[model samples]
Target: MSLFRLDASILPGTSSSAELADLVEAEWTAAHPGAPVTRRHLGTNPLPSDAWPLAHTGNLTPEPERTPAQREAMALAGTLVAELEAAEAVLLAVPLYNFGVSQHFKAWVDLIIAGAPVGSPVLKDKPTILTTVRGGGYAPGTPREGWDHSTPYLRRILADVWQGDLVIVERELTLAGVSPAMAHLKDLADDLHAKALDAAREAGRQLAAK
Candidate 1:
């Protein structure tokens, strides 16, 4: 079995988002020994600034010398999109940035979603499991959840690309400190991680069984 993990943490530390992804990977590997895994860290390799212009304009092949930066940018985006297209299941570790996915994550999404039709998406039928880490609670239906564009935005994107299934694991109120409040949230996060691990393992098993 093969699984693709996308890490979108911009911070260069032991962030909760990174930990969640690691747990998912570790659980998957333990459940299905010998399975192949590919982890892509978007923050470490940011897309070229010119990539924004070329990609936004619907052009994949940009000039080499004239646009040296965009050359690699377009290539990286294309390669990542191709990998997503080839994968059976995708595990995304997303951290909310101003109520939505990180800019790095948005960059990857821009590349993949650009390939899909304006209204009808091509990547729509693949299952994706997303885990989000935030400084506070933003679950839907909650008071402040409306301010959360994280899951909603992701859900919309998945719908546009081609929807197979969507699962969310949210870790909220992370900045509240190590007091009882934060501890409660951490426990919630742990539970969410466990559920995410289960979903990921099941998705892998389903893909492998096929």
Candidate 2:
């Protein structure tokens, strides 16, 4: 089966979100023994910041009368949507940026939505795993509780908008050992990271089996 993987970690080698996604991909590879993987690294090759507006305008304009800029934007959006449409399963690795959604990921989503026909879901009923890593704790009762805005937004898009069967594997407190202010939560951070990896592996296996 084909798998589409999207990575949105700004930091290449040091990103927990990417690492966790690797674990899931590894598991899937082990199960399929050579399945094709389509990778899109938004961190390094982010969609143009203006692509969204152009896509929106293109979607509104009739195809025969579209401007050159609008045509290019629509073409790019079609390519992005094609990647999703061609895959049997999808994995999105998103790292929390400033306690909010990654602008790159959001831009990608906007393009996909604009590229699709009105009222149609590009990823309808597809199996999707959203792997996320947060630098700080945002659990209930924590100082930064409710601070996570990315996860919910992602869920709304993947599960609600695209109608995907979504599963989330999250690891928080990732900055415990790296950031001086979070030093006290190092042990918990490690534990949470371990759990997220384990969950990712399981999710991959299950998706591959399906």
Candidate 3:
């Protein structure tokens, strides 16, 4: 059994989401000492923005009449789907950018959908962990309540759409220590960060157990 990890943090090395994912991955590696990990870092090497549209259209075109670009895109989509299909478990680290999902991640998702059959549960029963980091607090009573537009969409795609057995490790106020405007909430941010770390480990243990 193998683990497939996708990182969507543009910041990569300094990404809070990736830091949480590393914890989860470490646990998984500990549980399965010799298992191989398949990784795709969309941040460092993003997918072409237009690939999704080409892929979507490629699926509609006849194999014999498809253009070279269309055929190539279709093939790329197939490869993406193949990775998900081959993995026993999956981990994704994504950050909230501009209160929404990153454009790179969006392209990846669209390509996957284009490759798979309509409404199909590609990850049905697969244990999946999604680590999502937010720069600001957006809890129910917070000033930015309902301003978060990333988590819900993530849940919909990972759990509802792909049918993965999803576990989420979320941390907010990630910028409290770095943003002068959020300095007053630094302590709160630290607490949230600690909680997120604990959650990551637990999620990893569960993934390994499964």
Find the candidate with the highest lDDT and give its number: 3
lDDT over C-alpha atoms for residue 49 of model 1 = 50
RMSD of each: 4.1, 1.0, 0.6
Off by over 4 Å in 1: 58-72, 115-122, 139-143, 178-210
Across 48-148, the per-residue lDDT of candidate 2 in tens digits comes to 99998998998888889898999999899999999999999999999999999988989999899888887577779898988998888899998889999
TM-score of each: 0.73, 0.97, 0.99
The residue pairs in collision within model 2 are none
* C-alpha lDDT of residue 33 in model 3: 96
**lDDT string, candidate 1, 1-210, tens digits:** 677888888774866666666665666666678877777888787755556566545354534434655555556666767777677667788888887777777777776655444544544666666767777776767667688777778877775445746666566666655556567567666666566556555544444444
In model 2, where is the ten-residue run with the lowest total lDDT?
A: 114-123
Q: Which should have the higher lDDT, number 1 or number 2?
A: 2
> How high is the lDDT of residue 106 in model 3?
94
* Runs with alpha carbons beyond 4 Å of true place in candidate 3: none
Could you tell me the lDDT of residue 179 within candidate 2? 94
- Candidate 1 C-alpha error for residue 77, in Å: 2.7
